[model samples]
Target: MNYEAFYQKSIEKPQEFWREEATMIDWDKPFEQVLDYSSAPRTRWFTGGTTNLCHNAVDRWLPTQAKTPALIAISTETDSERTYSFEQLHSEVNQVAAMLLSLGVKRGDRVLIYMPMVAEAVFVMLACARIGAVHVVVFGGFAASSLATRIDDATPALIVSTDAGSRGKKVVNYKQLLDEAIGLSEHEVPQVLLLSRGLVSTAIVDGRDVDYDTLRQAHLGAHVPVTWLEANDTSYILYTSGTTGKPKGIQRDVGGYAVALAASMKYIFSGKPGEVFFSTSDIGWVVGHSYIVYGPLLAGMATVLYEGLPTQPDPGVWWRIVEQYEVSLMFSAPTAIRVLKKYPLENMQKYDTSSLRTLFLAGEPLDKGTSEWISNALGVSVIDNYWQTETGWPILGVATGANGKKVPAGSSGVAVYGYQVSIVDDATGAECAANEKGMIMIEGPLPPGCFQTIFRSDQRFIDSYWKQHGDRWLYSSSDWGIRDSDNNYYVLGRSDDVINTAGHRLGTREIEECIAGHEAVSEVAVVGVVDPLKGQIPIAFVVPRSLEHVADDAGRAALRDALSKQVDNRVGSFARPSAIHFVEMLPKTRSGKLLRRSIQAMCEGREAGDISTLENPEALQKIDTIISANHG
Candidate 1:
């Protein structure tokens, strides 16, 4: 079906539409009510159905496709590899589930997973799903303090982690961090199951700590029945950083999540049974939960789990994986693509990446320059889709297959079926005309896969999202966007990130995109700084392709002037940055979102609020030094 037809049917008769879509999954008990929106923010989907996500993902395919490769695990740190078939995956998940059950982890209990990107991590997640336990998978890189905060909020019954994890050349003592986090929090975690990766020494606690291998051995022939749960039952709780200091746990439901992800895999990624799909995201992130583990597995496709960075070992590592595995579809973030862009395209040319059919990107805005460069370099269909941790799958994208349209470069395609997206004026809450910029909102009753509620804060969920549009119940995405005359949406930066200078509101993305077009520039982040005359002036922090060119004052000045001219020629002088500072790196989250707020705070000599989410917190110091040397 074409975009308009599918979207029209979905919005017009959402109940009927979702009912038909729900048939894709193997539900233990069919849903009677497709939607129950009698309650506003506390919306319920497939209220009466009972199903187990793990069954649909693994067990249903066991009889016929038992030997089909289910997961391909690639280790970036050691260049090691392993593959598991559907039967093998099912058996492992059953074993793990039996072990969890033996440890008193019953249905509805929360289990915290703080492990590296390993095959065992995937198994742990599936095992939790199989037994109807809510899995809170924390990113491994987070410090003990951050983990403590989550542990306190989640109050999980058990914790699962590896002794250590290797990221590139650095070895992370995950168990040590977990131990410290447990010590910091008042919540008593009764049990800890540690998986030894054979990389680092681990100190096991006397009464609580248990080796994962020991549990597996004891539970060898045990079988744990999949816990069929009501559709509205919580499946997972993923913590995302909030505007306030504390993180908000976004809870997702089982039945709706399964149906939504299965539909997205079929529609958005155009995945098919036996196809090899790869998404280079750590299991800690939502994309990994949807695409890497559950989505592809539910769609009966092989999912590649890469345990290293794209540029690890060499810049050509990503291309090598695609060629080696005959991967059909690949999804990654814009930052990863930009990092790859810094390396010569010749490295990609060495691999025969003919099998790669579609490339999808999200997690951050895909700048036009990076999109164009990767499209040309890969010689495949490259598309940028938009979604969040709350929205389980792609809310916007040019889906693959006959129904999909040609992707307009840099535009996150039209809204996916079941999502009615609108660009609305912030003040009036009225829809903006095409080409006019405004806040991006999703008119709800949001479809099944969307987050049901903030775990413990229903009021916060309402206040943060639902309250913004008043009684209209629009889910405020907190993003600025514009729809072109052609009906394609261009997501501007966050509404707060919009630069208002001399009565003109400019998106940082527009300026950054223009600056990125310059040959010397590798990456760029533009922030609006306070200015007495212009209200706020745009200042850019740029990472040049080569540091040698900007090693001296004269070189820096020449390069700045050149970039300024490029911006002026591309996006007008009014949009040009007042000053450009060359930096070695840009501060970003682990998921690849540039922390513009942190940069703005550093520039203004204020506290960069809650920087625990940063991938490299040290980058903030370099940013401060650059701002001081340039502006002071």
Candidate 2:
């Protein structure tokens, strides 16, 4: 069948369609049903099936792919490289599993992972899967407070961390942050496993901390078998920022997730076994979980786990890996591409990227300008996809599918199969007209591989996702999107205040709260401003309790510097505001609601539209003057 027919079958005959697709996965016990939607918008796919993610990703491929390179790990920060064959990976994963067992970790327990882009992190993840322990990976550089919030939520049985992780020449003290996070959390962990990178050192906490290598050495040559799980059993939890100012843990299931990723590898990426796959995303994000680690390995491809910035050690570092590994498939983000646009093309062209078949970009909207430039420069297909951390996979994207869909510029392509995607009116929840903008809605029963529910909160999942638009049962993406005549979807920015900075979705409320915590500030509004690079950046305007703190220009500068550092410590450095201006008042409406859109518009030098209800005109003018003076 062609792409349209394939998609129609998925919608019209979901039972037959999904059953056929489910064959791509390796299930220890076949499913009795393709889908059980009796309780949907909460669905359970491939019910009655038993499967192991580790077996599909590693052990099952051993007979055929054992000798081939399964994982290639590189770190420019440490100037090191290592490759593990499928057999080697299986053995190491087993060793790590044994180590976890020794630490009292068991099936269904949670292991909080705090490490960088290192091979050991991958081993621990696979090990957790091998023994059915759910792993929660916090982004390595997040501050103590952010980490502490996740700790209290997941309350892991164990924490796996490293001494430090390097960014450029600077080393981030991972142990310090983990120690602080543990101290702040209400839950007490039983054990902490440490991977001493020796890049930096810290005193191990006597009774709690244990050396990772020592445990691995004791369990060397051990074989830990896969722990089979029912299809609907929870696999892992990933935390994503919500408007409520706290991160929500997105729960994923076992069998359905495996089948979804298997189909993605074949139809979407069009990657073959023994070929190389490269994704420049940290393991902390959903993309890394799906593409960087699971999907490629399940397809029997060699996946690269890379560390270090794309520009560090020169812009050629990424391309060098591509040329060296002969990476056949690549996945990255638009923000990274935008940053690369500034550098000379020769930095990329010098490397022979002949093996690269397709380059996929996601996490943020892909603009036409950047899309066209990168496509022409690489002389390859640049496919853009759109999805959220909650979704766990793309909602709208282009792939080498049955129809060989033609990508329209500035759009994220058509909706993938199994998604009953529609552009709908925000207030009324009615479907929109052709070429009209609306909230992207999924009718119900979110496709396989999508999040099962919010961890520890079934009601929150229903309220936050299913019934976001009041009484509407549709799944609101909470993002503004427009559909073309051919059904190509263009994702405008987030409809809410979540800011996508370099593909990291940060809550504006989180940053504003961090800024407001400053004793010098009484009120603050944080807005995401447009950027030529990095997609968007946070900008803050603060109202001080006393002008004495910023009585002069020099005083104001000092206050700004202080607030910037405070955000760095309270949040992560990536969340630090690009600029913070001390203002006597923030622009507000007659109802005392802050005019965040107008504030953002002024920062971007755009027209502030429909401000008749704006109560304070001078407040906006003050911001305009501040922005103008900075540019002038």
Candidate 3:
């Protein structure tokens, strides 16, 4: 069915709709109520049900698909690869589950995972789910202080890490970083399981640290039963940096999360039982937890766990993997596509990408230019989806060609089944007219797969989201957006990032998109800086298609003027950037989100807050130099 029909039926009968969707997974005890909203902000889904996420993702697939490949892991820098069948994955999960139990880990205990994107990391996550432990995954590159903040907040009983992690060509000493974080945290972790991926030179604590491989070997052949948890039982707690300078833990429930992710696999991704799916996301992020680990496995498909960047060895690494594995569907952030766009078109022609069916982009606002470029480069349908960490799955996405849906270039499509998105005025919280820009809000009770509450901060959850709309009960997405005449939703940048220039408000995304349309520009970020006349004038930092242009002062100046003209024509003169600086790269998070705040800070000659999440810290100094020279 197409999205129109599916969405109509879902909204018309949400209770019956979600209840029917819950039957897709295997449950030890079925739910009595499909949704419960008596507690206002803390809405519960599939109440009165009992289920195990590990059983649904692994054990149920073992009998019929025992020999089928369930996971494909690729290491880009080392050119190493491995595959695991459903039977093998189940056995490894059980072994690790047994090991966690031996270490005194029990139901509802928090287990922090700080490792790279490896097969063992996936196994550890599933093992924690199997034993009913709430897993907390911190990104591998996070600094000790960042890790310590999460450790103190969650107070995990045990921490799982690796000796080292490889990204691109650099190896991060994860064990050493974990040690520093543990020392920094006030909370006392009882045990640490260190997986020796390569060397054993890292110092291990006498009583607290244990080798993961040794523990797994000792627990080999042990039988561990899956723990059936209530529908409201916490499945995982993922920490996300908030605007308030504190990391907030997002809590996901067992039964509802599994049901929602399974449904999303079928509807959003068009994934089948045995198709190969690859989502280029690290296991630390929410996308990895849903699409990489749980979603594909729940759909009974082979999920690719890649431990490399898209442009690691060359620009053709991702396409080569697609051809090698015959990947049917792929999902990635727009930042990767923008980076790949820098290479010549001949680079993509070297590999056969015919096996790739549909390409999905998420995690940030995708510009129309980048979306069209990727579609033409890969010769496949590219779809831009919209969602957040609080929402476990996609709230907005285009349907695949199989569903007879037209993929819009820049729009995030219509709302998915079971979600009601509305554009409302920021001041009054009143619904806006069509094609009018306003704050994006989702009317609740939110569907399954959405977060339940902020960990240990019910009031904060209410204050941050619900309180904004007063008695309306709308979940504030904190994003600015516009709904077109055809019901297509276009996400402007974050509401806070909107620039006020000469009494006119403009979105940074619009200016960035206009500048990115230039042939010489590969990626662009626009931020507002204090101005004497216009209050705050927009300035842009652009990455040229070729570094040679950046080295040539004359070429850089000419290109900047051309980009300014392009923005003025597409948007308005008020939206044109006052100054444009050609840079080597833009600061970004590992998950591919542009660190606009960091750029804004650099422009104002101030310290960027909490830059520990930056994927390339070295780029900040370059940005500062470019901004200073241009301003002078």
Candidate 4:
């Protein structure tokens, strides 16, 4: 299909276009209306329909794929691997649903799932959907305080968690964290279903905690039927994990989310039945929820659920899975590929990834060097798509398997189907000219699979996402972007990430990308620090190929000079960072997103809040130690 005409129809005649797409899903009842826009920002797709996410994801596939491998779970941390057939997955999901019912969980109830990357997490999520309960899967890497806020807001009837989770050599005591979070929150949670993995000793609460094994044993041979829901009923509430302030619960509906993922799998992901799909992300995030679980399963494809780091045990861990499962479609973040790129290419080349057709990257901007390096290394097409937690799927992406699509080096293609996107000025809300940078905004009613509202706060949703700009309603992405004459869009970075150096606005990513081009630099992070003269100045933290350059003051100074010169020549002298500090690693979230705000906090001699969520707190500690000893 022509990408231009296909996308145009979605915008021009959304009801007609989406009604045709709605045929992909198996709805319990046909929708009375294809599109409902009576509430401007609060649009509904396939209104008056009844459907269940679990039925579409698991049950519908069982007829043709009963014996086919539905989920392939691999945990390098524990050195275990298992694959479940469609029939087996259905049985497992039924057991969980029965267990949830035994604990007094019913339709419209909320269940909190705090677990590591294990197969049981998938079962619990599917079970929640099966019973028509809204499941909130908080990242297991979060600290107790962070978990407390979500527990209070969601007010879950029960929390399902494991005793412990392993990350490389360390074991995170999840039971301990859950106990602490329950202590902090105001809401009284009735029950805590614990999955004891025996990695650590678990102390169960006398009256509140229940063992998962015992309950599963009692519920053996259970066959809980799917709970059908209205098209607009919420499926889940994913709390946005921002650097500061309170988190927002992003709510998603039943039919719209299902239709969106189904369409994305068929058109955007090019997923097919019986094929294997792999996404190197935790189930807590939106990408994992869509591509890892719902998207692949909805398409009747076998999905791979992996636990452990990309470089753990060996850099060949992910590729080994590709060879083992013959993954046709794979999704991962750019930072992970960068970590693998730092090592020898032979590590990845040893595995036979001939079955892999394409690798999709998102979560952050992909640099040209990283993109080209991974594409060459994998010997597969590397496609980049752009989206956020608020939007359930990609806002802009090239249709998978589309021949002769002209994808630019740094662009994440054009807008996806159903998104009426534009680049507009922040102040006047006027559309920017081609090649001019502006806020990335979408004219709503948002397409199927997009977030409905901030959970329980429609007014805040309007204020935050859909705001009146003169005569039109626009959903601000809070990111700056530019569109070329060919319609390819380039996401520069977050609008707030722009640094005003002597009244010249400079994107932190623009400077970081320039610094990353230095020959000796392996990775770089740029954060804006308060400066008396320039209001905010860019400060860089670079990771070199070796620590030998940073071992001595003279070598460190020379390397910093080279990097500054590179940035000055590439970007501009005004964008050059005030000081370039060398560190072995940059602080990042467990999901591989750079912790720029945390780095900026340390640079200004302020407390780095919430170090618990950081992938490596030692990275930030090293920076502080070095600066205090020498640079200070």
lDDT scores in order? 0.89, 0.85, 0.88, 0.90
Q: Whose lDDT is higher: candidate 1's or candidate 4's?
A: 4
**How do the residues 1-632 of candidate 2 rate in per-residue lDDT, one tens digit apiece?**
77878888877888888898888878888889889988867899999999999999999898887999999999999999999999999999999999999889989999999899999999999999889999998877567878888998999999999999987667889999899989998999889999999988798999999999888889999998789999998889988732224669999999888888888888788988999999998898788899988999999999999988888899988999999999999999865775566577999999999889889998766666567778998899999898988888888886585565877877888989888899988778788998776788898777899998999988889888875445335898988788888889888656777688998877676677667667676667889998889999999988886779899889988999888898889778999999888888878543234778888888988988646435568999999999999989
Q: Model 4 — which ten-residue stretch has the worst lDDT?
A: 400-409
Give a tens-digit lDDT track for model 3, residues 186-209: 999999999998843699899999
Candidate 1 error regions (>4 Å): 468-471
lDDT of 1 by residue, 570-602 (tens): 889999899898888889877677889988987
lDDT per residue (tens digit) for residues 1-632 in model 4? 78788888899999999999899989899999988988787888898999999999999988788999999999999999999999999999999999999999999999999999999999999999999999999998899999999998899999999999999858999999999999999999999999999999988798999999999999999999889999999999998876355679999999999998998888788889999999998898888899888999999999999989999899998999999899999999988887787788889999999999999999998887788888998888898999999999999888863322758877888899899999999988899999998999999889998999998788888888876766668999999999999889988899878888898887788888888777677788898988999999998999887788779989999998898899888988999888888888888888999888778888888888877678898898898886577545
- Between the candidate structures 3 and 4, which one is better when assessed by TM-score? 4
Q: What is the lDDT of residue 597 in candidate 2?
A: 84
Clash tally for model 4? 0
Residue pairs in clash, model 3? none
**In candidate 1, what residue range of length 10 has the lowest lDDT sum?**
464-473
Judging by lDDT, tell me the better candidate of 1 and 3.
Answer: 1
> Residue 516 deviation, candidate 2, in Å?
32
List the candidate 2 regions with Cα displacement exceeding 4 Å.
241-244, 468-472, 497-632
Residue pairs of candidate 1 with colliding backbone atoms = none
**Candidate with more favorable, higher lDDT: 3 or 4:** 4
Instruction: Report the poorest 10 consecutive residues by lDDT, candidate 2.
Output: 238-247
